[model samples]
Target chain A: MELNKDQATMSENNKPQDPDPRFACEGCSVLLDVNDGDRLVFARLSGGAILKIGNKNYSLKPMIGAPFGSLFQVESGDEGSFLSRILPVKQENKSNNVIDDSRDNRELVDNNEAQNLTGEEIEAMRREGAKGDEIIEALIANSKTFEKKFQLSQEKYLLKKQKKYAPKVLLRRPFARSICEAYFKKYPERIGFLRVDALSLLLTMANVTAYSDVLVVDMVGGLVTGAVAERLGGTGYVCNTYKGNSPSSVEMVRMFNFSDKVIKRIVQSSINELSSAKTVSPEENNQQERVCNAEININEPSTSDIVEETSVTAEAMVVDIVAPESKIIKAPKAGAKASKEAIEMWQENGFSSLIMAAQDQDPWSLAKDVLPLLSCSAPFAIYHQYLQPLATCMHNLQQGKMAINLQITEPWLREYQVLPSRTHPHMQMSSFGGYVLSGIRISTT
Target chain B: MLPTESKKAVSFKRYIEDGDLVIVYERHDVMKPVVVSEGDVLQNRFGVYKHSDWIGKPLGTKVFSNKGKFVYLLAPTPELWTLVLSHRTQILYIADISFVVMYLEVVPGCIVLESGTGSGSLSTSFARAVAPTGHVYSFDFHEQRAASAREDFEKTGISNLVTVEVRDIQGQGFPEKLSGLADSVFLDLPQPWLAVPSAAKMLKEDGVLCSFSPCIEQVQRTCEVLRSDFIEIRTFEVLLRTYEVKEVKVDTGNMIGESHDDYNGGLRPCKRKHRSKEDGAVSLDSSSNATSVVMARPCSEARGHTGYLTFARLQCLS
Candidate 1:
């Protein structure tokens, strides 16, 4: 690669370049310039074919091939190009520590400048971005001296321009801000509901479309509403009067109130306007109904208008209405009596009978004793305080309650035991048992 | 309860006393006392002491032997209670209690939750572990057995960290109030799987939970829960054995159980003697053999499972 470049550059020069000496062959004594225009061939004495090179046999057994002048080319026969020999170059040594005359060399250039132009005149030429050869040529043409100060000024100008326009590579993520902004916009309402329990459940339900805001309420709506508003980042309003003894009613009223407004804007307003039909007086209910009916003109309502009606009538009792697609889950208060009442209310409201066997304190001792009953199904939820009730539901389903379906929110049940027989004298052994059961059941279409 | 004196033959009052009761008498001259009763006898070279001499004597009073040797009697305390206790398993030793109590952090007012009411020895300590306001809930599936264990708790009068329940926790989670309420939970079960999640639920955030498993497989499964929900999971095994330490003279010649002469072959003469029928030797072989056989008889190794304790702490997420 080096030889080809040297030859290409030398061909463009007027002087003949030195021939490369590494290509010399050992078999025959010859100096071969492969780049010169000379054709030389050496054939073996017993070769079957005769050798030909540029129409002449330099030698039959060996060859010394060299060409003079810059335009020379080399060619050979099918035996291929061969070099016989070339001598190595020898270098002459000067005084080992000799220093060249630095002042005399400077004097020659100064005298030239003085005879042609002043030093200041030469310095002007150097400042005009002159190359080494250009500077030399300009000095000879104008007979001006080479000035270092002008050269330094021109170099500094070029360096400054290079620094100003140099391309810079910056490492940063350009879409970071936009991605974050888009995320915040998408979940502005949810960002505030990041409590420990809420976040845990949200993570568990990441695959779900969206999480419904769950509300647990009692008579103290102000306290619960205030807490919900602060913790969940939504307005919670107090509605006067108890809904019912049933947990489902409370759940339904909460759902009705939540779906009426966008969660984010609810924080700006008070929740005084939201009310369940159970909470309102009979006269007030009638007045609200009349107002709604008048505004919608429901007497001559269209099909869509009839579907949008809010009132839901069950067994001649007018309860608060629920949006068709909204979901509300209810849990009964802790204790047996409240749980039983809740279950009965749920059963009356079209929930299927999942488990209805009575369990008395001691059934054998008291026949026909009322036992705790559990009922559950889809579209209607029932909650209980104890695991036995839920277990009874599962047991009933296993025994073939086709209409009954139940969703268990709690994942596992734990039982603890302290075994007296094998415990250490000072260390008690408590046997703990846990069972994980699936409670969510989807109805088959 | 103070010591008092009685003029009685400490051993010769057999006729006046009940069966299985032995009496010792304090004699004036190793032979005679002021009174001697039936069903008791004073043991002496001269004759046996009668029950009449010792029957009414205060306990801990000095009683004389045939050769005028004095004997002292002591009343029993609960510390000696276990000596007569009927144990279903190898009872826990005191050596293990010191370590367990300190490590478990059982103290006053601690709501200690324990599962598997093994032998109630640990329960007794736990009762004492928390006193006054502290309470313990111990659960078991065997109702009949747990009732019996409750009787034992009543005897100890340490039922503070002790509540007995007869329910299988595998089918149900922890009681609602107990959920996230317990400060500590100890699990010792053949299969603790059903309790792990419930235990986690019952334990307050940052509460401590520990399980003792004899098997590596049990430890591995327990570690899975500890890693998933608990923080700072740790495992350790405790082994204890006793050594005898005694003072010995510095001089080689003064060493006991050592040989003085080369001909003695580093052996000492055995002081133990064999009893023969011709001599007045009473045979003790039958009783010794009976006890040896009973002691050597192996029961199931106490917690013969892999000995690994897996522990973790409930940690708050935020």
Candidate 2:
């Protein structure tokens, strides 16, 4: 983990040298001379020939596997430190100049003069007629020196090898799909509509829940929403509306009317059951708060009293329902009357329910009209709007002492694919941008 | 002083020389002339080729062009035969082919295996590498690509060391076919991961294996499949860009002159005229009268981005 001064210096010096000479031999200072058919006993590194000795030069051959420093012995002298001698030295025969005739017709020379032979020498003799004890004796004489050098070479080789082939591992954070899958598996019911902006909030919420599933209605872009849903094994439905191009007030009323019809078909029966429950006294604020501990409203309601108020009205006519600092001018308009009658009819049938208003629409007026018809019914209302208005409405509703709690779910921009060719031809490119809101009602029993 | 623009006038000139056209003919089985005359046109189901058009042009150029339609004129480059060579299987892309040639560490006289030869694209590259002394034993399961590949080799005049054979590598490994005698082996197949074991048998000790796969899943599978047989597996990708050339001027003064022209020309000239009238003399040359064309440089956009590449070295037990 740490480097010493000398080791660091050596490491710095080991940077790659230019014009790398190939096949450098460890055995000899003189490059092997192979062209003269001298039958070199030791193997030379291929292409290792860099210097010439006497009158001959040798090219390094691949056969010599030793490092450059091992083959040649360096001896310091008065002149300089030069290669004194090559290992497994050969003493050339100076006496045998003439051929001799014998039964084998081979010239005989003294073999005793041959010094310690190298691996290269042994291989060369094998190629020639020299065999048996002669080769064995040459190897035996050189074994000690060879072993010493080989061990040193091997230690250095292994250190270099480790530096080259060390195992490397890198870690990265998992993608969105992986995160969603991990959280959704824990609390499956909490996952709601899939949209990009909603998913971003959901991801943040997952962190808050310690990766527990919590309810989410994503109003983000379609593709990202779909991908998130797929990761969670849930369904995603895109709401078709451009948030920037909102409908007129008249159109808004029609949409609210349609929503009322939808609520009748979906939650009317449940509303009746909750309305028929034995009415508790309005003095149970503290006890009710204890029951809905985890259901703390994100916004302050306008109502001052935190107790339930009951009033049953006989007429299906319009009435002004007043709250603290706010008034419901058209209390029982056509759509409002229908919604109120639907809630009352459900209360007559006995069902528990919750009503969630669509984005950009008022939920208080509907709540006020319906509450008068079913005062014994505990109705929960939820709506989404810009932060300031929503917070103000919540404060007024809380001050007025209405039996309603407001939770602020942030508005999210949803992306939809628009046909560039058909709309906005000047900007002939498809892009996504639009905001929508969604809120959930939690029934307090 | 700035050097004057150098201009040289070129004159259109043509020269004609007399030469003899030697034509060699070979007898076909049906008695048709195999080698057509210099003036004769060779006709096939696809198109017609004028023998005369090819006589004067160098190799690799399209021999015939009628109307505006023309096929690529090609010189007899190694790549031409490599492209047109017959194959019993899928061919390697040019990107993978170039990479393998560099990775195998091949040199002249190396004995190479064009194994599992799908389409013979890699085989032709191998043949070109080992040419003059080296040889390529291309093996394939399909007979059609092999026969056509052999014909292509003959046409390219590179019959040396390129032996095409029909052999199924999966049923019986290439070791029996090659007899453990090749220096290098290149495997390009759908299941090269499966063929690695067989390639091990054919490759020499310290030999390399270059596998080409398009998908990451295939690469991962191949790596897992090759783990026991090879080591030092590395992945790489290459991108190629061809640039268009255009002349550009680096002078900033030209831009400054254009911007300041109206103010300097109108105001400075009028002021100078008033001063000249006061001095009772008129001058012709003025800074406001100067005008020059600022030439814009032409340039071409670079083309092409070749896909990813992965490589692994074979580690043999000594």
Candidate 3:
């Protein structure tokens, strides 16, 4: 029995270790990324009013859906864009005369033909299709002090009239980027000032690609998670480690019709599950402890064997912890096994990358809990709606033992409309795109 | 160090492999691609790093040199590759590349075409995202750049996913036989308007197209051509703002302060101490009420505007 045990140990020592697998891509389509037909569309008015045409909700899918913000009337069978125009509410028109606004104190024009005209006459002229510009011209001819006001006031008056007459343009495909802009226009508070420029920056900084194993905390609803999943296409895994158990408020993530495979790959585990996963059982720890104690051999054939032995021992402990952990984590049965294996592979290797974005969760705690899980050289990034919490996290991480090259950044997003004759950046844009703290994990020892 | 290159290969390994093009990450902004060969030796200030020693290790592995100095061995993901590649020419970075990929909707099994493969920076990403079943045809007028890009693909192990050809798409207009077969076409060439007509013709029904330009004049001209055959035209500029965040502990007794939102949880215990010496006029209450605050400032080195991505889809007929 003693001879047999010795032989087993010798052969086990001789066994060659395998290289871990890299991320792979398998055609994750874009339709699943945004146009899954479950998209949440908010109109550009009143805290993003839901745009519902009959029983059907429109999304940017199939590229042929009804445009957003176009005033649609339920016609006999079809909705026509050109046939509909929103009119000024009667209440507003009534209030316009009741309130003797100071703007009307200017001297009246002596054009008696216009002063003789009453409200009914103006209403008749409007109903009869008097061009807004022509009506404004007629009114201008009647007023004697039209040019007396300051430039800003005059511009404001023209803008009010323009808004009253202008038609709402139809927004097609209401994709994520457009949705962000729309939401920003309406309830900027709903999305936390997350702009398309900011979203793209997060995705880019995270190194999101097809077939990568990504871990994220998407507080901007599913914006961050969904965008990363879209980039992963279909082959890799993106595990969302959070602090709670219930469904996330990130409604946009559900809008994407991710495949069962993709959904399975997305493990919505609580932060406790991750924190517990980080803990190796004492028995397994003892086994690794024994493995570590054997590392003093000077006659080892090569450095490869020495490294391989310790890596394998560490890998075994990871497998022991990850198996039960994944059950609650609920990783995909197959592709997710790779994810667990990846975690096991990185047991001694370190983390591939880390991405953190949360509003309620403290950035410092989130980074601290997840930092040690990363490999020594893995890249990590933290996203916060405000910079204060992120700064605290950065400060805390700086004093730690595992991270290096820490820095926070805020991207300045500017847009320009390129046209034949008129080309310039939009006059107004949001000043805040949120802040990101990105750095690489390192081990000093 | 282990003989990482000469070891038994993992099953469908996702980690770094021997002979694979890996990026040696020295720092966040500093990296270089090195083909890890068995038995090869790399010299650095830290010490000698043996390529063979990295063989069986996973990607993102941190290894030590002879003097115990360390460096990260990372798989050359397209993004990392873009950062580490020799700057043969002006390159399309992650911001622009991601914008084009997404807006163009270049899925796997979808056929993608591009002109003037500048640094093969964008092609690497395309090849990986649309690998196994999809095809990426890249054309460059510069013969040497094309040849060099071809070699890069071969080295990166994505030659099968991408095809490199020497053709001035603006001058020759993508191969005639390829007309109406492309799912999407991306143009990075100057005078892209000269090729938009042909690109329009090459796209499949409802196929999307994107053009990257640095000037508004070029986009204006291109938009004119695109209007003839495309719809839903849009131009976007992706700006990246990065911030450096840190927490500071200050003496509230003598300091005027601004309060931001409070962080929900603490990563570490805050070392709070009540101010022993308090002035009656200034101290409204005990100084223990406040905690150290965190703040973030934009990194001075945050990259400014890279370029513009113009996207349009082919006009669809019911």
Candidate 4:
């Protein structure tokens, strides 16, 4: 135990040396936004990796050395289709009142014969290696009603045609904001419908910062754990405490592309282990710890395999982009057992903050046990899909005088379309982003 | 209130020593930041508390007053500081602040720039996000407000992480010394469009910029300017609806109507002697039917609107 403590301290003293996060490196996780969020995919960058887009598989090699936020467009060469990085040309400010031509959709008809070009001709143009812009121009010139439409509608038509013939993919660094958003959009149930704004609120209310021992009950996968570690930046511990013998799956942490130092800070411990009295002998404690690890080891292989498979299938189902499963050179594994020294420290001083996002579990039932693990006056936030449980939890905490400043807040996030002469809220917005119960723990004595 | 040293970490067992800052938490809504001094005595509605009594005690512990009333002395955090800080200007709350930090992707070792450091509310959290190695250069037009913000940062022990300056960013733009060095830039100005070109110049390739405005007109103008040199321009409005929880007595009555005599005999009314006969029977029936259950409802009053957050990423074009 003493040696382990020494090693942990020594590692803490060594500053983190992670790769520059601005550029997408090989083996790093990247979020691919297809055609301005028409589709989203999370892929690991490798030489052999392929992302299927609109019936063509594009090699991800071009994106490996490119800076994140670079735009890629599909191009056809003599050999095959490939993705080419395209630099955006500086455009003149055209966001002024250009829609004042006084043309409306009065004479627009939904007939299928608006264009003179056929599908075979467009295919033939593609075979001849014509650029996407050239093809769009040809299609526009052949359209019978293109000249009669309103300017805004014509622009909309051009955008629609561009999307079909010249789709652009944006390369993005996978941070907590993008990851939560991608999951919420594609697989909300997997993350308990915890929106990005809601996740941000949880971290803020909990006061997660560098060197804080943040405790989390992450039934919402590893979203919370990964987010806390990102803020900690390899400087603190984000311990995921669970209810039973086996630890909950935190496979989402892998998506953050965390460095080894940051991964080491992500550990897990059972609730019993955390709250148990430290009266047992060191040898007995060691035996219990070994048993815990064995149990976790038994569950690791199958769960990780499921995670890898789901990453591909998630994209396949959401956007029909059959992502080729590349060889996942395992990053340093997170969620190791909490060391004896660290657990002992937590039991002595308590965690700095607590964030709970347990699914289906009653908030009051969990808070009653977890509140004691937080230091007095330490802020804690609880997330629930329903309001009733969090409300019950807040009421009980107040009645028991276990905490102060108890408030249950639900986050409402609405996105807008900020365009010229047409700025309003998006037609479809998420009505519910879930609720959070936030408060500060107070000492009883 | 970030932990610059391992021993001073939030989870570390550090005692409340002299010359330390602590948040005197009286209630959820009422809090005050106090600097601990050896000869100081804090007098409140509870009573008088001597500074000597709080020394050597761990943070987050309760200290009693002369009348046996107690208040918790908590280690300060940016979240708590936001509540207790003096409002010099309309400040951004947690919802907007958190979203901006996350959306900008500001992490440790990232240089972030903010304009019109209003009351330094969001600046404190930004300092925390870019602590230990990174720095925040916050500019404000009001000289006195900027000085006061610097003092507040010193009080919070984050002056090392943040540099508060007096500069009208909208009028003069950011200082040229910071050109092409920032990882993120945040604008909370009246005419944020006036500063958009300068903000673009300050950000590195692929960096993010966010503009906050309370009115739709301001957002419209800002987005127009941002579209010239930015991509993925998005606008969002985030608000929090807080709920108030209480344990109230509710009656879970059955559908079938029952006779008054049946209720009168169901439960005993101990206070029957103090009430009339009919009143006693009715009170007894109500008591028998009512059960205490915890419930929650949205607080009738809340901040309905703060501001619309407009976020954009610098075009990746070299």
Candidate 5:
């Protein structure tokens, strides 16, 4: 009864309580989706923060206090162009009905004479402060083939022009799904091409949930770490174990906007520290913690430098920019050294699950050492970009009789267009996301 | 499968005790959920196994039967439970379950609502994702199935996180008490379009709703209804292709040699025999020409079509 009381109080303290939980408060991280996923940018909300849309900088001040999922559009005011919140007008489902159009694109050639409006005239229209819709209307009025095209073709033409002229920005909450997708699209190599489906599989296969001690080897830039911490929700711990003296950079954890309670659950420890049989003296353990702190402090500046470089590259590609705030909001840093008590508790009672996403690392080598850290009956999942490594790893584990129910899975994800008369599988799909090796660790004795 | 109550957290101390629920793993494809009682015995193709023999051993360890045949005792997880649970109805599998949970964006402290809790397969995962503070309100039309689901949740130690009720959600809709309180809602009904309004009313602004349908006709009807109150509506079919791995010996030598071509099959059967029994030396070392390599191929039989998952976000209109 006493132990239960202690745990109840501990969990109560870990609950993420905020005054306004779902609103986009100042200094909180937000994901800005531009033009219906044409560009995705992660930015901190601040009064001084600016987003560059179409070579024009707009203050993010109005966006600060708005609820998530609010849509913004660019408008030219007397002072300058600014982002203004626009309520989406409810439209009927016109795409669900089949269109029996007699028109064809055979007569429509890709001739330069289709539009009579010149570039200079369009620029003149923009300078005169015409709305994006008005410009689109003027363009359509001047186009020779606008009325001759099929219904779907005309809609497509209008959408293309709308995107270049007036792009919409959607404010989204930064969850694992969105963060993983943004990274997978912008920098797949940084996250080892671990697709969203594959990442979800890893979490599910490992059985990560509330109040479970999860051990992870997250070499894929902290996407796995952040994802695990997100699920744990400050109730348990997600200990990220490494092999060498320097720990892997989990810089991606900052993007999830995790609370301080959730951030505290994400800690790092070296493989030697976890596997060491000997207990450390109180004095020595304190000194070791100090050294770990020093290492983290030394690694801080470089990681933030990488963050800036990444955002700049995103700017070059899709204008995925981050506004510089006047007052720095230091996000509570994650990935501290595991506490001596926590590490010892894990050593005594093995972790409930394990996940490894070490890119280019041999799965067998890592599994041989890490599989023992999980309690018998604990499930594990290993992700690799290639199948050969996982195949070899599964073979060795079977040979050694260390695990049971071993199976390698490749997640096949296909999206559909889902329109009237056009509902079909997407023309282009990701053929290969990655491979996973999953099983339950078992005791040999 | 999840330790929602603090008292049950001690059950995960890594040891098996009496009254514990364990999965007896016989092979990759065969398993069963067994409750440990002091006097009960499990008889399988292996042999008769006494429950008393498994009381003190750690989970994931092998337990031998009276005839020396053994099986591994595994701790219960939601995934394992999905495979072992009695299928009162056709259920959702891992691929669809994982994708739905992720796409719904379930976190630790978010309220979720699910309908037609079929076999409690996906409901178990839902309970896992929303634990401690959040709750999962699951409704089913069948009274007996609801009772069974309640019993299963109680056995799995996640009853506190999940609440199963008997209600005809498609006919009557969800209870009005839960309106505008859910962060996400899930539906797996025969005519999900009938419950789309209630689902929309239950979700908060920008909350997500997912509907699972096996037929495109049902999906078409559901999508049409969802278009009124939801945006970014998308449909996806996610499946997993499992691979079978094996180590096989392959001959690496060229087949174009004149001596090799002389045989009718273009290659001679190189037999490896022990030259000396005492020394165990091989006469023809196969390692020089043949190598053992681990190779993998897709399993011949797999789940081709489970269902199409239709996901949408509630329009953020105040």
Candidate 6:
């Protein structure tokens, strides 16, 4: 409750909410939940060192009790004494550091058959200076039915105890791969299910590497931007574009904690500004847009008469898309003659790849406007949670014969709880890895 | 626009230059990497393509042949090289190659080892992934195959990035000198279990490893051995399905010689659901005989399953 008050005020600033990843040590921000097998999720821990997971707050690094992932309850003021210990966090993140090849499979028994000690007795044993593994082994060895539980169940019991008493949360040397997985797992709907596997495919397919320029329009947060920036290894440029008041996606990019040298490579512009010409006043901005559309249509090879007919139908469709509320949001009320210069600056520079994953915009119109800007034969990938929008965009772009090897695919993944003589796929895993529509932009001319 | 003109940062040309090896991509099913020697003629069904025409152009150059047939001369990035290379044995495609590169966390300065080079398709990709600073040591039991793969690497200008050796990795294991310095190890051989122990020995503590296998049984055997000294064991089957989308205009009843209602009137509910009003005009005329709008659809065929990639990290002894 004390930390919750701090968050409400901190929300106003644009700085990243979590500072844990920025530090090599444990947090003054962002407390991550360390589960069995080192699986991690966001469980905010900040001021007062309070960690609340579903109404239960576990005081971590608590001197008197166990550790962060340790299962224990504490009152508001009661936590101060334990937190003062402030033991330094464990630095290494090797999940398999505790190699347990000695455990054996067991048969199941009734709950009554298993013996357990009271919490006070366990606490007494801790006061006697028993380390994590010793206490855990002692508990297991003392359990009357330790040899009676099924193999999987026995493994589960050990994992639960391990997580509850582990000395600390999993400290990580955060990289793009780890950060993407952490954030996506925390907020899947917000990040648009851009799984690490699928994101990797996008990076590889777009050929994003060192010393290259990539145009990125991602609404799935800055997962793409961060991933691309890291791949370049502090070289090349990423043209980052956004639509809202500020880039909502930049939130994720900031989490990557990249150096200023790498961050400098990112050039940012607004979608409204990039789609229109610069040096065009409020009066001419709309006209400049119309002219830009017409200029691009010149490559369509359609007759003038046909274009006029198409223009009318396209206008109707555009109007249909604009709800009364969104119309106001979409309006170009701000004068943009200055931005015309900005738009020209980008047009002069070439992009090796185009990547997009936005939920709010029509992918067809967005892709058509941008695909031509891609250097000829460069790759472009548009990711969407639903396939209908990408299919529509592919249909529109195919009319010009400007792309080949257009593909929509989702990589399938299975996690196996690999153990000696007991390896099998996890009971339930993700079947949907999201979908990616990728292709190479080509020019017949 | 600012104060004194800032010196423009002069840079070297990174794009395709003359006398470079680039893959000429004709289509998804057809591609070949060629040495860009000026005046060389590439005769194909599209026409006789002159190499001089492609000089000074960027990679992914969409150029025409003598008779005006078209092809894209793409930079021989390992992914493109994998597609266009002539196969000497069963090869890995871009799907598996990309997954392996990412899962293994291959970065600059990371030393990677691969066994049974096979056609050197995947080795090429791995080399490009860990280039300039990192190295890829690939071992093949067959001496002839190893020699041929080494030649391919030299031609592609990545001989320095990857070193090919003739050795039976599964039978004899990776060389003893490479004991524990590798950042990652990859196996593409039969009976990868036979080499898993050696791979474990070569890795730095917590080093990553990946194995490509077509059969579940092979993956199972590999996993059984990896369990003793590995964590985060997972498998992936990456598939790429290409769809060709094109719009077909249907008469809404008035465009063609027939009435617009005549088309929708005869259609059942299922067929009616497929038709939508033309969002854009189809032609110079107000409308064609087709009263319907063109919509995209998947082509008759699609590329299917490639192979599975299994990844694990060597356990750090405590």
- What local distance difference test score does each model get? 0.33, 0.34, 0.57, 0.84, 0.83, 0.61
lDDT string, candidate 6, A129-191, tens digits: 555557779889889776766555677788777655443343333456666666566557766
Report the C-alpha lDDT of model 4 over B84-111, residue by residue, as the tens digit.
Answer: 9999999999999999999999887789
Best by DockQ: 5
lDDT of 2 by residue, A1-445 (tens): 1212432343344433321112222221122222111111122112332223222222232223322222332222344222222323232323321233112313323465333655677657645544333554455455433233333343344443222221111111122322222223322222323222333332221111111111112222112222222222211111111111111111111111111222222111111222333454555544434433422321122121111101101011111122223221111111111244543333343112222323443445434333332212122223332334333444334334333212333322211111111111122221211111111111122
lDDT of 6 at A177: 64
In candidate 6, which residue ranges exceed 4 Å CA deviation? Answer: A1-33, A36-38, A42-146, A150-153, A164-169, A243-248, A271-349, A417-423, B1-17, B56-62, B66-68, B176-180, B240-306
lDDT by residue for model 5 (A198-264), tens:
9999999999888888999999988999999999999778999987667788888888888899999
Ranking by lDDT: 4, 5, 6, 3, 2, 1
Q: If you score just chain A, what TM-score does every candidate get? A: 0.17, 0.20, 0.53, 0.90, 0.89, 0.66
Across B244-271, the per-residue lDDT of candidate 1 in tens digits comes to 1111112233344443243223212221
- Cα deviation at A423, candidate 2, in Å, is 44
Model 4, residue B6: C-alpha shift (Å): 1.3
Q: Which scores better on TM-score, 2 or 3? A: 3
Interface RMSD of each: 37.7, 36.6, 10.3, 4.8, 4.1, 8.5
Q: Name every residue pair that clashes in candidate 4.
A: none
Q: How accurate is candidate 6 locally (lDDT)?
A: 0.61
Q: Among all windows of ten consecutive residues in candidate 4 chain A, which has the lowest summed lDDT?
A: A1-10
Task: Give lDDT tens digits, candidate 2, residues B89-166.
Answer: 556644445445645644345678765666666676666455445688877778887787787666544566588888
Superposed on all Cα atoms, model 3 deviates from the true structure by an RMSD in Å of 18.0
* CAPRI verdict (incorrect, acceptable, medium, high) for model 6: incorrect
**Residues B1-318 of candidate 3: C-alpha lDDT, one tens digit per residue:** 101121211112436556777778766666778888887878877789988888877665587788888787765556667877777899987667766776676655578999988889989877755644678999999999999999988877778788999998988899988888898899998899999989988987567899988888888788777776676677777766555343433345545554422232221222211110121123243256444544555545545666777888775432
Each prediction's DockQ against the real complex = 0.01, 0.01, 0.20, 0.47, 0.48, 0.16
Q: What value of lDDT does candidate 4 attain over all alpha carbons?
A: 0.84
TM-score against native, each model: 0.29, 0.33, 0.65, 0.91, 0.91, 0.71
Give the lDDT of residue A307 in candidate 3: 60
The TM-score that candidate 3 achieves is 0.65
Tens digit of lDDT per residue, candidate 1, span A303-384?
Answer: 3322422221111122223323222222111111222232233223211111111112121111111111111111112222
